[model samples]
Target: MFGGSRRVRQAALFDGASLPRKHISLGGWCGPALMLGKLGLRTEAYPFDFSRVTLDGLMHFIQNGFAEGFYPPGPPPYRPECVGPWVLFRGQHTAFAHFDLNDPRVQAHFQVKMHRFDAVLDAPERPVTFFRTVTARHPQEELALALDLEEAVARRNRSLDFRIVFMVHDQGLRASAVQLAPLSPRVSLWALRYRGLPSDTLFDRTHTAYHAVMLHSVAEENWSAVKVGVVPPPPATMASAEGWDFERNVLVCDGAARTEDVPFADLTITRFPWRSHDNLALIDGVASVGGTCTGIGSTKMLANASAALHVQRLARLKCRYCGDATYHAAGRPFRTDRPFTDEEDQLVLIHLYKILTGGDKVAAVEKLAHEMRRGTYEVICRIQYLTNSSTKLMDSFDPNSLSDP
Candidate 1:
């Protein structure tokens, strides 16, 4: 006896923060989070590598130690809102890379030995929640995992209390129609795809009109809808718009053009100063507790934290470059290529002296550019003017100021 109507309502909440979905190869949690956000589901993503750890190893952790807050050290699993009857696991995108799941032996292994859903099926209350999706970036891979898992479940236990969902990407729905049409009644299917692609000029950009259509399809549960070609390009007026307004954190599009507003937080996380999005979310086996180095797990979380600090430093450098804080404090507009004051030159010398004395002349000029909010070319010219034996600016200033803190 399933819990009936109450279970339907609870399951629809769609809060799967605990399981933390990611494409891994794609932009990780940021893209998935954005897509889910379009559907009005707020997820605090904590991504982990689904490919590295063995399936049995993951199951063991959940079965033996999930209770008493013994969940993985990454992503602060103790958050109250993160809990739900449904648990989503990000399937390995490359599950079928080398081996075929269709092979009877492999199917048997998953059904008899692996027993992946034993914990969910054997729970105390008969759960009415649909088996939350097993997500993957590749539509073919996700569809395969869904179909095979559903088949294994049917062979052994046909009277499942909850629906098993097979999710296909919108781009993959047309090609997958024949196989999907014949799915068992207990097994449902949904079309969920990420549409946003990385933009060179901005953190991310998407076809605003196409995105609305995609959102509508998902919201209505239209699993048969297929997305074709790439997302349609934005309006022509957007191309003529002014540059990025760093102060407003938005592109200065024409008034007639629709502005695609990506939140600043999303921008930073997506454009993480780090090399890639791999380590943004806390991993189950990889991220240490509190993202520190002393924990019993991998130190990738500590490295992520360090990378976040580095991003903050970069932001500060940009602020100085744009004269944001300094000009704003003085109640003046930031002007570019203004003549440097004598005090400013002195400040530049104080910072550049350390780098120059270290025998890295090129680095000294670069460092001066960052410190003085000037271009590298200008910094180089200024350095030459200051250092020349016959220069007038070098004659008046005391060399002792270069050594001053």
Candidate 2:
């Protein structure tokens, strides 16, 4: 079916250019010569005028035709993908296809049907209506439509009805209504890459192809979390003057105090709550007790609580790289080029532990002063410096950039 006489007049307002048929398919030089003669564009070396042919405009034409019911079904000459459903309509700018949104078979499979109502209403005065329905073979399974078609009809101001019905073997058939929405005019064409399999032959090749699908959206936001291990210093021993020794316990942490439990080499627990502020408190310390640092056993015990909190915090953020975000946020700061020192490493562990345990701000600062062998004011200043400088650090080391397997 075609649009009404008045609607046809309105459609005439949009007179797009005719695309060259030769460009539609792959052919040798002879085909192009024949096509040029047919279209009257050939004049020995004279370039053809392509003012009307545009990817966007062509896509709009096809989408509009599909919405307006200008296309009829037949034994198509080429495969769906090769010639492309919209390619033939390139010459008939006013031609379109009527997508059966109410098709029961399609509804049964997809559950939802997205129609390009926008394309149908290109000529606002000519509106389209779509119907949908479903059926089940079992009496217990009753078919239904979720969308309100009447409301859609009134909204689109269309006279045509696109009815869809489903057939059930025993229960018979049922019908429903579907609301049609406008189709976007923008179209993007991309070259797809396909890899042939070993069993593939020229006549029957099986290939894996990858293509990107784009959608229009109003807004979007992305965030991520990193995990860092915090290992406390071991108690003072005769063998080493350092208060703690991670090598004996088999666990060593990177600068920010996120904890992790590896094999014997490291028994660190990967704790969560991946914020830089959270890790700073533990790395520095809280009050008189300074922070607790036992062997691997105690460290693991402490990490349990910290890790839980970290996970909960990450869940709250709803970040993409949840674990990595916590790790990076709690890790120790170091210039990419410089090597870390034992004292610096020990401090990192202490800071991570304190932060993980929900160490009090005032108490943690006081403990850091005692452990680092620095004054309370000095420790407080260091915490402040780290807090302020970390903003810049996170910008560069964004945990969101990391991919998850």
Candidate 3:
């Protein structure tokens, strides 16, 4: 989904839908605004940390402008642009004020506000409200926020249907904790996990890709097609020399001879240790068709075999590397919270190696826990500390440091 033609296709699909005119980002991080800007939509930011504002404070802001003493009437924290109701219109990058749920003043103004702003405008424009938080003060903070949001929406008029997206970044919370969090009919939680190569660029790309696919599905009203198109079944494994074929060829660069198939016997395929999956797939394919560089049978058979084998290989590779792919099975019921033994640390590294070598991390961790007869949380914590390259403990320590005492 990265090529020029693929981008063009996504753009064309997006062009068909009537997107929101503006986005209202309720504090937290800049991710929502950044994503909205990429979609060519106007965004009104409330800034990060200020996203922790109480529901009452938010409702108050929508009803009235910034209340008296909401921010200091000085030049430091409160700026001219971030004052009054106009602040919402123009948008503010600074946290003018933050009201926690525990604040006595917040409890005083515990009234929900739902206005009909669209009614006043000639062209009714739908504005989406997006909020994302990486902060987790308490274990149930996300669930509480979700519940508070639901309450805010529930008390309001049903006709004023504006989309409110509350995103909570996973902070190593248990599956049970997440399951306990209730969801409204309109509210949906999307758990996007990291595949590999944890970087900002990868995150942006992954989020954008998902955004495109989601838009396409929403536009087409074919939601089920998304999973089908994205996650195809892995092809049968290539084992013996039956339907596999390997060819060594060099590209013909000349303009006239470019169309011709030029075969070069001396082409060397360098096998790298890093590309274990690719090398393994190729070896299996070669062994299946015929353990030789030369053609085994008819051109059609060879071509079909090559295409099918590659397709399967790619499918399996994608599943292994896909962040959204579910790898952990749920059969174990017991949980343990104990210190990791030296032997357990070694097993954790073994699982970590699988993840580094393009294996599904969830599956690896689950397997590690099962094999070691330990809890998944314990295994995860062990891996986290060991892989923390910033610490001297990780740098100085060796995987094979355990001696035969």
Which tens-of-lDDT digit does each residue in 102-147 have in candidate 2?
2334223222212223333333332221211111112112111112
Give one digit per residue, the lDDT tens place, for model 3 in 1-405. 000011232333333345643344443333444444445442322323222232333443434444421332222221111111111101111122222222333334432211222231213355344433322222133334554555554454444544444443331211101111114434433322222223233234235433532343233232222331122211134221321123322222222212232222211111101111111111112210111111111011111222334421121111111121111111122346566789878877776776676554444554676567564444554676887843211221222221101
Residue 89 CA displacement from its true place in model 2, Å? 30
Each prediction's TM-score versus the true structure: 0.26, 0.14, 0.33
**Residue 138 error for model 1, in Å?**
5.5
Clashing pairs in 3: 240-288, 241-288, 242-288, 244-289
State the C-alpha lDDT per candidate: 0.29, 0.22, 0.31
* Worst ten in a row by lDDT for model 2: 210-219
Model 2 has an lDDT value of: 0.22
What is the per-residue lDDT of model 1 for residues 222-291, given as tens digits with 9 covering 90 to 100?
Answer: 3333222112222234332333344664433222222343222322211211111212122222111221
Could you tell me the lDDT of residue 321 within candidate 1?
15
Superposed by TM-score, candidate 1 places the C-alpha of residue 126 at a distance from the truth, in angstroms, of: 6.8
Whole-model lDDT, candidate 1?
0.29
Model 2: residues >4 Å from true position, as ranges? 1-116, 119-147, 158-161, 164-405
Candidate 1 residue 33 Cα shift, in angstroms, is: 7.5
